[model samples]
Target: MKVDAISNDTAYYFLRQLGLERFNVKNLNAGHCAKARSWESKKAKGAWSMSRYAEPDENGEVEGVDGQNNNVAYLSRSNGNSPTEQLKKIGLSANKFTFLRMMRGSTLRALVPYLNKEQLLLAMRLFPKMLLVRLIGSLPKDMLLKMILHTIPLKKFLALFKAKVLFSIVANKRLNVREMVNGLEHLPREELQRLMTNITGSDTTQLNKPELLGMFRELDKLQLMNGLRKMGQEHFLEFVYQVTKKDPQLLMALPRGELMKVVNSMPKPTLVELFNLLPKSQLEQFVSMLPYKALLVALYQIDNKTMESLLVNQFPDLIAALAGDGLEAA
Candidate 1:
């Protein structure tokens, strides 16, 4: 299954269907609910700390509890023969949720290999972003490749490229440069062009597009990120535009001033297209970013049909309210 097989439409539909289901209290298992509540109480009491294992010595070895390292000692209690055995022992020793709650992010990362696909997906959704970063980093390079190529949708997977996440992964020395490059290689050529131009600070005019992209293979994630930082706002705006073209709502992720600047730079026609592309949920935010004068100007340029579509399709209540007020005035 190629990544392309899992279309954004399919993923969006799956998530939408999931969202459509209503919660039913009757479906809850009383035993499981009590256990969950107990986990929460323990969490609130700070009983979840991962301090059972001794701190490592200067040599990075924890003292002789069978000579296991800091990473393994707690999970195995210095007894288990393998990581799977260690995981099984730990799981058996306490409430499953409580045991998980006590595990550090790194320990959870170490457990990823023992998890099946459903378990991995659950971990991905439920883990905190910081912990997910570590868990994702811990995945074997080939496994990560397989997930990107066959499991995750392109749009959903690319959301991991946020600056903080990438910076943290690089800072922790967990970034797999080849894997990162391979992912980039899978992006559309136009996107790759925009990204490489920003990273290299050389447009297609300065270097052959392919030659510039070739440099991407030699760069590590850190350098690629730093190059983006040094690329200046203009290029960064273009990069953002390229990345968010299919999902205009993502433009809101930019700083308000930066987002306004990017939107303001567009011609009236382009701005109209952007407004049309934006989801209804984000319409208020997009409008809020524009000054009154700019907003009126952009709105004035939209044709009557487009304006009606925007009003009816994106703001049905607003249109109805305006019509009601017009009738009252009449």
Candidate 2:
């Protein structure tokens, strides 16, 4: 349901078609981030509410429900007295807009939870599988899960879950190998074949080291940890080497003991390369995360030339002192 596959430009284009002539993608993204911060603050305080179609005044303020000066005239004109009646009025009034377009707008996203089963079915029928993905992604997490469980059938639900896992694999989310392999089982045979072709190539040769690393780069630290945890000692070293070649940061996701174990298993040259690749800040963090004994063992195992290079690069003053240079002199 995560809609990373649908670009901001696509959303912008759709909004423009749906009568938002002045829709700005940059403003939308920035505004969403700002709203997310505000929502987090409100959430921490245990107070937050959303409405599907509240009209704000010139000052961008809506009267509270408890206000003495409620919009009595508007309420009266909306037809039924019950909350369901008001919701039906809103839904019918906004009938021209498809569920896809509604999902794209922050205000209209609130309307989804109020949709009747028949209305929900109609919307799903109108939407393609991918746009349904967007709708699933657009809803708040709790609402999305609840709605999916209640509304979507078992087979389609599994298919969507697989799609979500696939999207995460290819996108920045970089979910680990285990989840990816498990999710693949849910996909149709044809779709699975297409996924394989897309991952390797049309020619279907085995993925080379560089190609594998390229795919690994998409994975985050936790994902790397999960994937690496299952690897054999030799394969772990090779995979970690390839991962570090793409990004040493991915290794940071491992727990302290696991990291130390891998560090112990790694060759001196690869260890040196990893240290060389990390920035001073990250190097400090990496050192701080591991036990001093593990670090000492690693230091003892390094060859003199590699140790000298590491010392000169990371601690010039210490190197200077070792060579009998005074503290104030090089």
Candidate 3:
């Protein structure tokens, strides 16, 4: 009974809790899944062996296989001889730490051939999500697209790529969109649609001129505020007018500091309306990073009661300044 639904931990847990039925990825239905363990798999045809988890320590430290060494003694006494016995079975000549480090340096391309069908199915679970997404964003479009095509655990890869955390990181320029988009293109139409929805909050089919124009216009505004060629106040206002014609959410692509800069420089009415469009949680986070002048300017927009509530409810330290004649007094 190969079960597709119980192919992950969350699915297994939820189903078993709801019914008295335990499930696992390897054998959701016993005798159904044909996957085998790594040890039982045939040796890799290539020189790069995934089963051969060993590397020499550069520091020249050697650990004895006998139970005399403290670590080895503990392993022998507690976990029994399974790990060391397994190492001997595989002819690996390295300590546990060295073996772990080798796994750390292992690449999917080089290691895939050595994985049994079971390991291949579960392989995506091991990726360091944030680190890999950041790295993927930096890769040239061609390279990133290729990796996405060959990657295991397509579900996790898609989930990580479509995560809001990845979106924010990309917005702050920690990840490049062009490379991200190129990689996204390799996804099937369904996945590609989901990614666009995560990013734009609209169906891919619904994205017409407004979304694209809004995004490009906002990027241009960001470039002017912090790019090579700067625009004057009048031109910025004109651009802001164009941006206001669309959605303010797109402007969120700007770095936090740059977002504040844009707010500080905008006309009073525009600034007030712009902040209104911001989510309260995100706005409060940005407020915490605001410079004294920008924060002071923002204070003038809200009422004394709202400001007092903010001081009392969230920013207690600002209460001293709010109560006093000026910030310098606090």
Candidate 4:
């Protein structure tokens, strides 16, 4: 006489509706009373009825069930408890139960639009576990449920839900290692260094080149290059090479200020040599940082109008560099 053994869809429908605010017990089939009585008779002398209308146990706690038989038994045996009280004994809040019951009658799709993005994400994560548990628990008395239940703990099922959420968030490109690193900034320096090392080593080996590149792109978007640079030349060069190899265009598109900072930090002789090697377009961008005296000296050596045109016409950097030095020296 297990409640689950009953296969009547009408019976389940009638019981599920008990949670509904407007649902009336009087509307259920009259024959359900005999079924409820049979269920009650199966219980041991002092065993609790699934219907909670009877007196509570030694702990003064009532247990209730949801379904037509239990609802019918509750209605017949009530010691003046209201329907709301009866529903509460079964661990369901009146309003939530009402919504659940309504969902059974109407389409659940209508309720989906009302859920926010976070709520939707939460549902997506939890629903699968819920379904899995139901599936495992509902296996026939063929010992399948018992065997599976022994092997899979409920906590593992919950962990699977969290793993699913993480996978979904990461798979969609909305989350990545760099963002995760930035989030851990407040941790100890040693912890941060260890975390970065582990992430870089594992990601570089575990992920394909394209996936690693996307991760680096996310890091750049989060402005974490400075932190990466601070990690040391070896780490920085590795990072730079990885990024540059994947996207040469990104280096060309770097912000002028950041590019200047990187250039200025290089050794003076190397900086000068690198500056000389840049294309005319890139070289023109550095006109502001070039020492005016150095330019004037270099200008005398150049046989081209490009140098003169930049120095005479667009030389704010040249002017500032020159002005910073006395006219006597110029």
Candidate 5:
């Protein structure tokens, strides 16, 4: 049936009637669409409408006339078999059929703002089987349907539907923190660390103490402390004091290349913290020794707009800070 067939008043009234009867408002609306489509499709093939009958068959079986059955009446099966058996053989479960009808109806309503009555109706007719497969053959159909509904402009419909469906799904299946951390493995080191901090509920300034300690233990066991040191001083110190408790042997064993590498890999915030920990002379020397590339990298740690303003004003100290390392001439 065309979406336009169900006027707002009609839809509102239908929903109200369902609410009065204590049926789930969303489910009732979905069932209404299913009923409408079944009616329309049967009418298209010159079959009797449900309004003309008391109820569907008690056996959940379709009515038959010689070779024809109500449920499979539209299909022209070449094989000689009962229609119910044929439907079962094709894996058409009751829940799937119900979900198929609901998606078709929801899609129709979702397209109402963007489509004319004719286009909406045509899409409604075409999409049911595809939606059914996408819903049933993969993840939960309700989740997929909710995602589709969200992308559409039908916010009121989606709100009612989502309040009844999606909220429960998310609550039941909370996202895994470990899985979220592992998912960041391919990201750039700074980005990966940022994502890991976000996943573990750590702020940019303070790492998750427990999770970070655990991660450090793993890295230490793998003998990657040198690699960790090369990530930068803030990372190293944080790992040392916060995680490994400043183990003397571990500190002594750290190679200079590893320290530099870790420093280079640090996010700007952590780098700034490293700079803050250095004595004035050491900080000046470190800043002076930084290549233009390293200085540019450090600049990324600061806010972008602030950096832009700093560049525009040609701050002499900032320029001096970036000089040396042979890259100053370039």
Candidate 6:
């Protein structure tokens, strides 16, 4: 759009939509095309003017300019709609390219928060997946990931983000699991699981015990704690439980802080079983990292002699209370 032609209904509205800096319309009004100007009634109370000049078309619709006529109806509608919706609707064949190609980053980012699942899918279908992926890749990861996770269903998002599936499979075939994971930051979560399952020779049909354990160790190598954290504590615990239930020995692979968070979030039964599976050295590492309650529960599952030795080594004073009764009271 010409610098001088930005108007409240079109260019200015889009800038406002994306929260971009827009030229003041007063100064830029010099270039407002009269045809574009006539779409809106001068005295309309809102950003868009709805006027009927009544030079009806053959179809009896009020006449308007051919090329730059923007339907400002969306300007007044609700549901947190983008102004571009109207532009997209009427500008169908004409300026559709302009809306997508010339849109500012802020505008694109702004489009994310309000587009419902249906609209987002519609928009996704409008563009090629790679182009959409490139556009989405430009967004801040935290913001974009949250947008995909909370509002857009990950299954649907992955369906739209088919490259994540395609690229992940390609990368896994070419690179080691860690290499593939570390190399591609934008791979989808489900595809990451598929890759994990593929690498470990686990059945893709269902996640079995050995497969869960394999996923655990492999994802740990990928340093997936931060990503899991964003996936939510509930899902995080379920993920850990799957790993720990089948092969808790791999619990040692988790970073101390991440493991503590996982174990502490789990119920006592699961925490007990997971801790019981830890070997002596890893158990010691886990003991120091967990809080008093989780640590105490873990100790209850260890052999008396080993528990005593652990308590003596880690907390000498607690040894005295546990000396007589094998930790029934201490």
TM-score of each: 0.22, 0.18, 0.17, 0.18, 0.16, 0.18
lDDT of 1 by residue, 1-330 (tens): 101111223323333322322322222224323443343344346543333333333423221111123333233322324433333333322222222222223333333343333322322232223433333334344333332324334444434345543233333333355544544444456556666766656666555546656778788777776655654443444443344443333433333333233334334333333223223333333333322212222222223344344333333222221222221110
Please give, for residues 46-112, the per-residue lDDT of candidate 2 as tens digits: 4423331233334322211111123342234333243233333323112111112112122222223
Tens-place lDDT per residue, model 3, 218-326, is 3432332242123233332333323322333333443444223322333433322323333344334333332221222222223334433432333221121111211
Best by lDDT: 1
Deviation of model 3 at 134, angstroms: 3.0
Clash totals, every prediction: 0, 0, 0, 1, 8, 0
Ranking by lDDT: 1, 2, 6, 4, 5, 3
Instruction: Evaluate residue 117 in candidate 2 and report its C-alpha lDDT on the 0 to 100 scale.
Output: 36
TM-score of 6: 0.18
lDDT of 5 by residue, 78-155 (tens): 134433333333322212222222222222222133323322222222222333233122423333333333333333
Which is superior by TM-score, 1 or 2?
Answer: 1
- Cα RMSD (angstroms) for every candidate in the order listed: 26.5, 30.9, 29.0, 36.9, 31.8, 31.3
Error of 3 at 154 (Å): 20
Off by over 4 Å in 4: 1-16, 19-168, 176-178, 199-330
C-alpha lDDT of residue 217 in model 5: 43
Q: Quote the positional error of residue 326 for candidate 2 in Å.
A: 99
TM-score of 1: 0.22
- Candidate 5 contains a number of clashing pairs equal to 8
Better structure of 1 and 4 per lDDT: 1
